[model samples]
Target: MIRGVLALIPDEFRRFTPRYLALVVLLALSQAAAYLLSVPVLQALFDGNYGDAWRWTSWLAVAVAATAVFGYLQSMVGLRIGVGMLRSVQTRLGDHLSTLPLGWFGTTGSGAISRIIVGNVREILGVFSHLLSPVLNAVLVPIVVAVGILFVDWRVSVAMLISLPLLLVVNRLANVGYSRSNQRIHDAASEANSRVVEFAQAQPVLRAFGATGAGNKALDGALRRQQKASTDAVFASVPGLMVFALCVHAVFLLLVYVVIGRATGGDLSIASAIALIAVSSRFIEPLNQAAQLSNALRSAGSAAQRINTFLAERELAEATAPVQLSEPSIVFDDVAFGYSEDEPLITGASFEVSAGTTTAIVGPSGSGKTTLLRLASRYYDVDSGSISVGGHDVRQQPSETLLGQVSLVFQDVYLFNQTIEENVRLGRPDATADEVRRAGEMARVDEIVERLPDGWATVVGEGGASLSGGERQRISIARALLKDAPIVLLDEATSALDPHSEAVVVRGIHELTRDKTVVVVAHRLSTIAHADQILFVDAGRIVERGTHDELLEQGGRYAAFWGERSRATGWHLAPSTYRSDLNGALGG
Candidate 1:
């Protein structure tokens, strides 16, 4: 357990040695003083020296007081150290998470990682405190107690020492069982958390499908697993306690026998025999505490392993040195990517978006339109070839600088449970309320907020459930506008809006993209009729490219798509059903 603890402290702490050296000094002194004072208290009581007993009592009182003060200081020091360590961990985790390829999130649930940050970190803190102090106290206290026993009669001390290793071996074996049990318990716990999140996220669909019983049954199974794991963990500890109890009994017998034999041989006095027995108990006290600590240590060690595993995940690589941005155009040169080894999504793709122009990408579903947009944003590095944003290779530019130049608005929008203005202000957190209001106006969100009960300060529900689909999308656009980046990427931003709301948002995008390099993932080709360039993708390749009229003249894949779209001019029932379900949402 101690080895696990030492391994986690970063090199910064290791390099600066004075602070840790002082902590070690304080811990050693405190443990030694506590042990010496405790042994004398036992000796005075056994000798029946009333005056000496009173003297030792006063000394023990002082020792206890000193221990309390030292313990508090030690705790405060540990807390400071823990906070520093935790800060380092959180910063590193956040940085790594942000740089990880976008596809990683699709494969890994966000909730599980959230639990690692919040829950696993708390467990790690408790582990550090539990493992450190007990180890020093346990080691020092027994040695002091054994010396006092030796002064009375060396035979008793030797007998006690002989049995100590056997108890340690038994306790270690018990620790292994407990550790395995905790691993199962924690695994069950993570599954329960993941299931609850999944169930909650799908509540609307499940309720509509009338699968509440199935959901309940899933939760019940999770609960059953949790209960079983907890029961097994408790069961695993039973053997450890039994072993500790037996060891204590054996030590007690050895003390009594050694004292009686010496007294009968006229080699020990009655008072000395009693003192020796009393002191022997103190000698074993530290061992008993050590036995109990081993249990906590094992539990903590299991938690640490989980936390370490999470921290060990490899983050996306970046160049050792990065260059500055000097241009605003984006170029993809023979780029290729895949979500998995078996499913290639984009192959040998190439495109370019000039500054201050809107480039539309239109394709059938699963033609890599969205994947192409993700590449433009550097959410995933290309599997081959190069993506250059502002003339610097995307992977060779620092992530912060690359992301600072682009703002993305997508169909599915998320808002935190905060005031409307605050959610909009997230793009530029330092923006004033008046500035946020201006951006909201540009996104046509100000009009919606005016009708909301509390206006801009109104609290949006979690993930914006309190608002309409169109309303959420508008807020997302407002956030993007607030960012004021030179580049904007839109992924079917108006796909969720009613015709009226769609016009409003599309007009807003038109104005917002005026001075920016715009890349639009085109689901409705009509929306991008005025785009400076059009790229029609099929089977992960750009099958045609030209202006809207030019593509129509060519009569290629773009013309075929346009023909299919023209044939389906009327509204689809599913969209109408979805809008009806939204209850005439302001943006829907």
Candidate 2:
């Protein structure tokens, strides 16, 4: 447990740790000396040696004062180290998290991340102020007491020394299964937290589907599992506590019996026997205190393990000599990649979009259209082949340099809980208000602003929940326009909008992508029919490539897909028949 806490504390903070620990040991030794000094003072007073009693009494006073001084120093050093550990650990975790692969966040759900960042990080904070020094005292003070008593009563000292290892062995036995139980509780709690967040955030969809109550079912199950895990942990811990307690009591009784036997047999004086009792209690007191805090110690250990595991995760490797790009073209050269190696979603795929041209990727659902965009943006590295942007391989440039060149406007838009102007300004923090308003005009967000009570200054609320979907989409487009990056990536932005809003957004897309490189995943024929190039993806491979007219002439997979979409587009609801039937029957 001590090692676990030490591992969490940064290197700069650890230099003080040895000084703090050494002071705690000195404090314990002083305390043991004070307790032992009492034996001599009592023995001398009982023998009616007035001068000897006075001498021993003065020595005892000095020992107690030294204990006090050492204790104060120990606490001050501990507090300094504790406060440093808290600050350094949190800062280090943040820095490491920033370097981790972006896909790590997607694979590890928001709930688990929340647990590590909030719950587990909080657990590490308690190590210095709560668990560290007390645990050390519990282990160290017993050894100091056993050694001190050897100078006074070797017979009884042997019994106390023998109990130390026995108590430790029983402690290990008592904590059996606790580690697993503690981990289960942490996992279940993380799941519950995630469910609760999901339940709160998805209220609109849940209520629309008349499944608000059903959505609560996931949260309820997570909560029940958390509760059961806590209960099982408690039950699992009880036997160990009971066994440890039994061993401590038995050790105490053995010391008492030995003292009583020596006194009765005239090998020890009555005053010495009485002082031994006081010494025995001191020996047992620390062990009991430490035993009481075992659960907290175990919790600290578990927290360290979770944090260390996260810190060890592999980050995307950046270039030693980062490259710069002058063009905005994207090229995929025989790229093959997947979240896992065996089940590749895209394999042997190759394509290119020239600078300032639009290349549309069309495919059946789940055929890796979105994955292609992700790969181009370096969300995950390709398993084989190379992805290059602006004539430079992505791996050759720094992550920030590559990301700064691409502007992504996907179907699922996210807005911060800030005023409309503030959210748009995130695209380019230095943009003038005039530039922002012009971007808003281009994206048709000016129409949304005119009707809203707060206009451009209106707060979007968390995730733009206060606005309609079309309004949020427009806001996102305006943000992208303000960014004006060299490369723009779209993921079917108008696929789920009303005709009027779709037209407005299409105009926004035109303004945003003017003279810029573009790669779009398109389901709508309107977007696909006009693209400069189309890549038809099917079953983890690109099966066809051509312009709209060229593919139709070939009559391959793209032609078949185009024909299917045309039929779906031509269908409509039948006219209402009730009034027509009545008129016909009356011969009107």
Candidate 3:
């Protein structure tokens, strides 16, 4: 348990550990010494040595006082260590989490992360103040008591010395299931936590499919596994507790029998024998505490292991000597990437968006359109080949240097539960209110707040759920406009909006893209006809590259795609279902 606590402590705080442990040792010894001194006090009274008894009583007072002093010191030092640990851990996790590849979140899940950061970290912190002291005392106190007894009554002390290891072995036998059960419980709990989040977040989809309540199998299965794991932990502990109890009782009886026999044989003085018998009862207390704490120690060990595993995750590597951005262009050179190495997503892809040009990425759904824009931003490094911005390899530039030159406005927009002005200011926190208002006007977000009761102070509930999708997109555009980076990456910025709102958002994108290098994963084929270059990606490859008219002249894949889209525009829906102006969205 001490090893586990030390392992989790950061390097800067390691100096405090020795001091903490030293105090704990002093405390344990003082406690044991104080406990054993009772023997002499009892012996003096029994023999009618009143003067000796008073002297022994003064020494006993010193031991008790020493225990209190050492204990107090240990607790103060422990709290300092724990506070430092908490700060270092939380800060490190936050910084490290920011550097990890975005895809890691998709695969690892937020539930597991929250478990490690919230639950496991708290458990590790408790080790210094709560678990460590008791566990260490449990081991140290018994050994001190047994060894110190040799001076008082050798026969009784020998019996205690012999029983110590036997009791330990029995206790060890009882805790065999503890570590394994804790791990199972940890895994089961993480799964259950993830399912609960999933069940809540996917309520709309689940309810749409009539899968609420008992109809949700994934949540049901996860909950069932958690229940079984908890049940198993309870059952696993019973046998160990029973066996340890029997061993402790038998050891107590043996100590009693030994003390009685020795006293009658006259090998032990009557006073010493009585003192030994009383100290023997006190010995059972620490052992019992240790036995009961076996489960907690194992639980803490499991938590430490989980925390270590989380900390070991690799983050995106930064360049040792980073270059400054010199231009606004983005280039991909023969890149190959995959979520897994064996299955490539985009293979041997090469493209360049020169400074002050707009390049549109047009492709069927799931054809790696979004991946291209993501690559340009360097969210995940390519498995093979290189991506560069401003004529320098992205890997040769620091993340801040690279990202500072780019702005992102993806299809999925997220807004914190804050005022409209606050959300816009997230793009440029130091921007004046006038600057934010200008950006809002350009993005047409002024229309959104005009009718609202609170206007700029109106809180947009979680993820902007209170607003329509178009309003959210415009607000996100306002954020991008406020940022005003020289390079922009837009992924279907005008998707899922009514025609009028779509037109308004497109105008905002026009303003955002003006005189800036833009790479757009465009859905509206007709809308991007004027793009300087078009790349038609299919099945993870850029199969066609040209202007809209040039691709049409070739009449190949791009022409066919455009032809399909043009024909799709003729299909109509009722006025209430959708307006005909949704041609781009419907045909995209």
Q: Which pairs clash (backbone N, Cα, C closer than 3 Å) in model 1?
A: 470-587
lDDT, candidate 3, 176-199, per-residue tens: 886678888888888999999889
> Which portions of model 1 miss their true places by more than 4 Å?
7-65, 83-88, 128-131, 198-203, 212-214, 318-326, 341-343, 549-557, 571-588
Ranking by lDDT: 3, 2, 1
Error of 1 at 342 (Å): 5.6
lDDT of each: 0.76, 0.86, 0.87
lDDT of 1 by residue, 494-539 (tens): 6666998888787777667778998998867666588899999989
**Candidate 1 C-alpha error for residue 463, in Å:** 1.6
Task: Compute the lDDT for candidate 2.
Answer: 0.86
Worst 10 residues of 1 by lDDT: 15-24
What tens digits encode model 2's per-residue C-alpha lDDT throughout 36-55?
Answer: 88888888888888799999
> Which candidate, 2 or 3, has the higher lDDT?
3
Q: Which model, 1 or 3, shows the larger lDDT? A: 3
Off by over 4 Å in 2: 44-73, 208-215, 453-457, 577-588
Give the local distance difference test score of model 1: 0.76
